[model samples]
Target: MYVGLVGCGLVGNKRARGLGSNHRLAAVADKDLTRAESLASQHSGCDYFADWQAVVGHPACEVIIVATTNDTLAEVATAAIDRNRPVLIEKPAARNSKEIEPLIEIAERNGVPVKVGFNHRFHPALIQARQIWDTGELGDLMYIRGRYGHGGRLGYEKEWRADPRIAGGGELLDQGVHLIDLSRWFAGEFADVDGYVNTYFWRMPVEDNAFMLLKTIAQQVAWLHVSCTEWKNLFSFEIFGRNGKLQIDGLGGSYGTERLTYYQMSPEMGPPATVISEYPESDDSWEMEFAYFIDCIQHGCEPQGNLKDAKAALRIVEALYEKHTSGKSVRL
Candidate 1:
């Protein structure tokens, strides 16, 4: 596959690497021409464009990867989908679901496949967790609890992430979206969402910490928190079910070693039987998601990270933000 990549920053580069040896980077684009050129230079026969539009319409490219800031995700993806090109857009999909609705309409009308970048779903531990749940050993799911946070670096408040206009909502829209997506994956779509967001530590207009409560039609609840105030980086997610429970911790690197544990309740139940799995290498979720994207394109199937999933996550996000802004409860 020939690819047109936009952003040329941390995530964009990761996407490029994820394409691996089978796919070619036909063109790269960034607001900074130098950054685009730098990425393009790494691959022979690759082209660099100053404007993202050029890369979007580049003749040699069959797929589009949008890794730009949150605000540009929908705009660039909508454009690419308008041209009948398949797109793997980095998530939130846009600043909010409102920005993504039109893009979804466009994609459905044109039958163009759109994949959102919720790469965490592809992590080995998560993949195993999903498999275990699918076997029905967990019985009916009860609730999920997740805590994800990171310590910000020097001058963090001044980054583009600090600007609500550029990055949309703060921690909720950032790492929080991953937790929301995971909850939905295990428990199905949420029917009610409520939350609080506050700039407890950062000086930015956007909140540095966020708390959420999501409930499904079945009353399966997810209580989650995401923050940048944690002095020690952390990631923990626990799911409880009638017959068993699953706990996933860390995400490799600064998040520590990735691991998942499943506790199955015996019928006579004194102590539950526990199973553990660990992933010690660098995160390959990027590569796994890319492979899934390619398979979806080949099989004419919608991706697991399709626009619908992104919309669902955004719905929860918007609901939470509404609750925070209005200081009232949010239903649906």
Candidate 2:
């Protein structure tokens, strides 16, 4: 398939590499022509444009990847869907749930496929964990606990992420959505959302820290926390079930080595049997996720991480923000 990528930034580079050898990046675009040109130069025969609309309308491009800022994600995606092009939008898909609602309607009306880039779902450890979970080895799920955070670099407050108009929200919308999506993936839809968001370190309008306590209709709980103030980068998710527990630690690279540890409870209680799996290789989640998106496009199937999933995550984010201001728990 020929791909058109909008946004020639860090994530855009990752998306380009994730195309693998089977697909070609035929067109690229960024507000900064030089950045687009630079990305285009890396892929032979790739065209560069300053206007994203041009990439969306490119004659040779079959699929569109929207890796632009939060504010423009829905806009670029809407243009592609309007042209009958499938889109793989970056996570958090929009500034808020409301921003993604219209895109959902447009895609459904056009029968266009749209996939949200929740690459973490493709992590090898998580994949194995899901297989184990599906086998019922974890028994009835009881609860989930997840914590993900990274320390911001010097002058980080000057980036687009620090600007509310551009980022929409702070750490919550940025990294918190990932955790929220993952939790929903494992446990199910949250029936109740009670959380708080605060700007602790970064002098930005959005919160630097977000804490959430979510519950399913069955009362199963998901305790999640996301922050940009951590001195050390970290990612940890633990799922507890009646028969055992699954704990996923790190995300490779700065977050440390990716590993999943499963504890199978003994009928006799006491110490349980432990199994650990580690993924020391570089992150291939982007490639795996892209491949699935392509498969969904060709098979005429819905992606696992579609706009609805993104909207669900964004709703949780919105609820948390609202709860913080209203001082009340939100019923979803």
Query: How do all models score by TM-score?
Result: 0.98, 0.99
The lowest-lDDT stretch of 10 consecutive residues in candidate 2 is: 197-206
TM-score of 1: 0.98
lDDT of each: 0.92, 0.95
Q: After TM-score superposition, what is the CA distance of residue 302 in candidate 2 from its true location, in Å?
A: 0.5
Q: How do the residues 15-128 of candidate 2 rate in per-residue lDDT, one tens digit apiece?
A: 999999999999999999999999999999999999999999999999999999999999999999999999999989999989999999999999999999999999999999
RMSD (Å) of each candidate, 1 decimal = 1.0, 0.7
* Cα error of candidate 1 at position 37, Å: 1.3
Global fold similarity of model 2 (TM-score): 0.99
Global lDDT of model 1: 0.92
Write model 1 residue lDDT over 187-213, tens digit each, in one string. 888888887888988888998999998
- Best prediction by lDDT: 2
